[model samples]
Target chain A: MVSHKPVIFVVEPFGGSIRWHNPSLPLIYWDDYAVTRGDGIFESILIRDGHAANLERHAQRFCTSAAALGLPEPILNSWINATQAAIEEFGEGEGKCTWTYSRGRASTGIPTAWVSIQPISDVVLAQREEGVRVMLSERGWSFPSELPAKTLNYAATMATLRLARERGFDDVIFTDPDDGHVLEGATSTVVTVKGDKLRTPYDDTILPGTTQAALFAHAESQGYRCKQKVIDVDYLLAADSVWLVSSTRVAARVRRLGEDKLKAPDNENEIRSLIDAAMTRG
Target chain B: MVSHKPVIFVVEPFGGSIRWHNPSLPLIYWDDYAVTRGDGIFESILIRDGHAANLERHAQRFCTSAAALGLPEPILNSWINATQAAIEEFGEGEGKCTWTYSRGRASTGIPTAWVSIQPISDVVLAQREEGVRVMLSERGWSFPSELPAKTLNYAATMATLRLARERGFDDVIFTDPDDGHVLEGATSTVVTVKGDKLRTPYDDTILPGTTQAALFAHAESQGYRCKQKVIDVDYLLAADSVWLVSSTRVAARVRRLGEDKLKAPDNENEIRSLIDAAMTRG
Candidate 1:
């Protein structure tokens, strides 16, 4: 049996209209800043029940990310339309979608923007079910505050993940080199639960996690207190439960931090149910 | 009048063969890690006197960078031949060539590699002649030692340059945020000259600059003392001359660091001549 490719769309200049694009053909030039310098912004969103989850929040963050990079204000209508079209074609129950907005070709100032939708893979499901063993790695330096854009510059992150895999772990969480405080996971925001409190690292040193924020709101409605602060290693290790949360992988419980093993929290099923409800509602 | 485009070539898998590719057409897919995650490495070399300057040194650094990213070891012969072919077609005199090797599409584990040659723009020449007004900006954080690679994660670099331009400067010199010491330029290495001494910061915290290394070698043969050490603001301000050296720009003298104006040193021409000799010989 032949496999079907994911749905992809390319948005025109000034966010005019998005064109259905062939995934097999090339879509960007060599001189585009996206590839040449990784000078652009992107967002990954979760699709569920034929709808994009928390798209508004993702779009807002996408705009903020673009602004940080001095990119033009994105046309939300165009992006929303493209996302909807892609999902409609994908015919999905569960999948992930991503939007890439680049600085365009060197010769032309027009931006290159695209959206792609793909079904969620089995590995992600397995990660959710079995949990992940994680290691702590320092992200030595930080980007200056003046340009606090989470642009497409993830070489260090990827390298750190590779280092973790080599060391026989499922993922890695980055710590601030200066103070040994938790920053984030390679591709997710980290949250720790202690009793009724849900704590995540402060957004000052990392990208604000859309899924985490949504889950926090839902948990708060369920009488769970939520706070964002500087998280140290000891605080993480002492938590009753820890989760690596992102758009696609809604919540993957951390089974281990370093050599210390962690057990599932007493309310693990309840928390998962809350996350599902939050994502589905959004 | 219709304008001509730069020469570009795409390398086949395993560096088998290179085909001249049209710069106007899209050459990379949306899902390629080069664009998605900046999971790649690149090197820029200066083309001079009908040949690529310091081809062997650049290739060596390329391999080192690839290793840092856990990329497949580069085929040196293939890269060299492609560089020669591109130089031959570019047809002599003052140009810049870059090689980009990226982790390929998400579905395929094969790598994507390409070469492109473009003429040096007049703005670069102007910066060299008139000198640049540089502002000091802190890079805030550093990457961990295990992943000490200079991949195509240039978003911060480009943003820093943009911040400088907005503040009425030509470029930026990034300082280590923790201690307020010099790191390097946004795209080049920092070198300061006082009397007959040449000093650049130690390479441990930054990408080892190939141009700075070559220049120091040539300067040493010419009886100029060279040292690599931690450089503070006071030391940088007190230098008789400061230069930002790189592959494409060769050496751009810094006329102003922050608000303090500086005069061109007595042996500026002699130093330029030495640089020319070093590059031509290589």
Candidate 2:
């Protein structure tokens, strides 16, 4: 069940040289206090045909998120080059690479950054093919501003995912407690087609999925209606089609939620074309 | 500004030889990955007259918190003895020691186990004598049950402290968003005297402060009324005296909050005596 061609790459601190733990294994610096403390920021990107998909947007967001956490920005071009070198070293492939930047190690009690790349899991592709079952889980996020940027404090999200798995669901959907607005999935942005409009939660509460943003932009350019708005559970249940979007998964449709089953979209081909377009964007 | 004599100690991880990078500096394995990733637990204990204060309770909570995080308990007695040896090696009077256990490094993802011990800062003694000002900050904690145990994920608490310091305060008091219940300080317990009754926030929303709990038990035996219940900002403002309790500070009165200045407690001698008795487990 390999998702794509196999590839291996090294993760280095933002501006550092690529080294390996062993001559054969890529050296990733996990010695930093940040990785344990979750005191860093990261972005997941897709590499297809040796090009990083949505690299600029991912880098910009990563920088912004890092700034919010008071971390120095990793040299984006160096990271890109390092990632490219790793990808080339592993040979050509359709896979995922995660770029993580922590605060550099100093006496200042911040984190030192590191990055790692691995082959995308086959289960992601399988879910893309078969769609997925999701459960609504309380992540306890009350304010959008509090969670605007990505931080390493992800234990709550992990707990939600664990609970979702225990409950026999493939993924979890989080909501804002103040107004019960459907926020996003644990690791993905939520998008749904209601009648003729594609809608997503409008706020900084969740990570803005690069794939979802690009897909929505492409959808709008192609004369498909798209919008960002507060989505309630009732609105989600009545949506024509539900999709979870991320860098790796692209666009995974929601097959069943709780006891209610959903029908596949009539515009499934168009949605895939939008995903393909997103993947091709630099 | 050094108000107390220094006693220092170092501890090695269970089953590991005491390694030192330099003869004077003990090399302790700290899973920075575990600490930054919030994949570890830690305990701070007061060392007085060459003995760790509340050795049994501190060791127990350290094990309990680690267990809650799915980590196996390290050799508690060995670690304790190692600490004592370090203190003996360094000599002792009044100082603080921290024992931290993290899930060690993982091949990938997160770690499974690691530990370290180090001496506390000297500034803690200064704060004890001069008193400290605290600022009220909102943590927006809506879900209490999910975060019952202490983890390395302390970014929010750190942020609150930074915010407080930026506004000219030494510490911050966090409150619940749902009902405006005063929870506790970012790193200490909140205790205030309202008339003859000593009150603290209930134990559910915050970590059970060892020093604060012991003080309450000792206060009750000394004929001071003690109560643990939900307290709001208004109650805190109206208290006869407000103090923050922790391992290092033991107990320090809050002199001012925002624009409101509080008078030093009339029962200062009695309160200090109670705190001393509690520290001695009388």
Give lDDT per model, in order.
Answer: 0.86, 0.67
Q: Weakest 10 consecutive residues, lDDT, candidate 2 chain A? A: A21-30
lDDT of 2 at B163: 70
Report residue B217 deviation for candidate 1 (angstroms).
0.9
Tens-digit per-residue lDDT, A140-244, candidate 1: 756556666668988888887888999999999888777888999999999999889999998476878899989888889989999898889899889988999
What lDDT tens digits, residue by residue, belong to model 2 across residues B1-282?
A: 234333333334546443222222212222233532455666777777777776777777787776565555567766666676656654546666666565554334333332222345556767777778889877764433664556666665655676788889988888876677898887889999876799999847577888887888888887889988888988988998888888767887888876778888788767766786787772
Poorest 10 consecutive residues of model 2 chain B by lDDT? Answer: B20-29
What's the TM-score of candidate 2 when only chain A is evaluated?
0.87
State what share of the real interface contacts each candidate retains. 0.89, 0.20
lDDT of 2 by residue, A68-183 (tens): 76666566766776677767755566777776665534234444444445566778879988888999866564432553556666655655676778888899888776677888
Question: What is the lDDT, from 0 to 100, of the residue B193 in candidate 1?
Answer: 92
Tell me model 2's lDDT, rounded to 2 decimals. 0.67
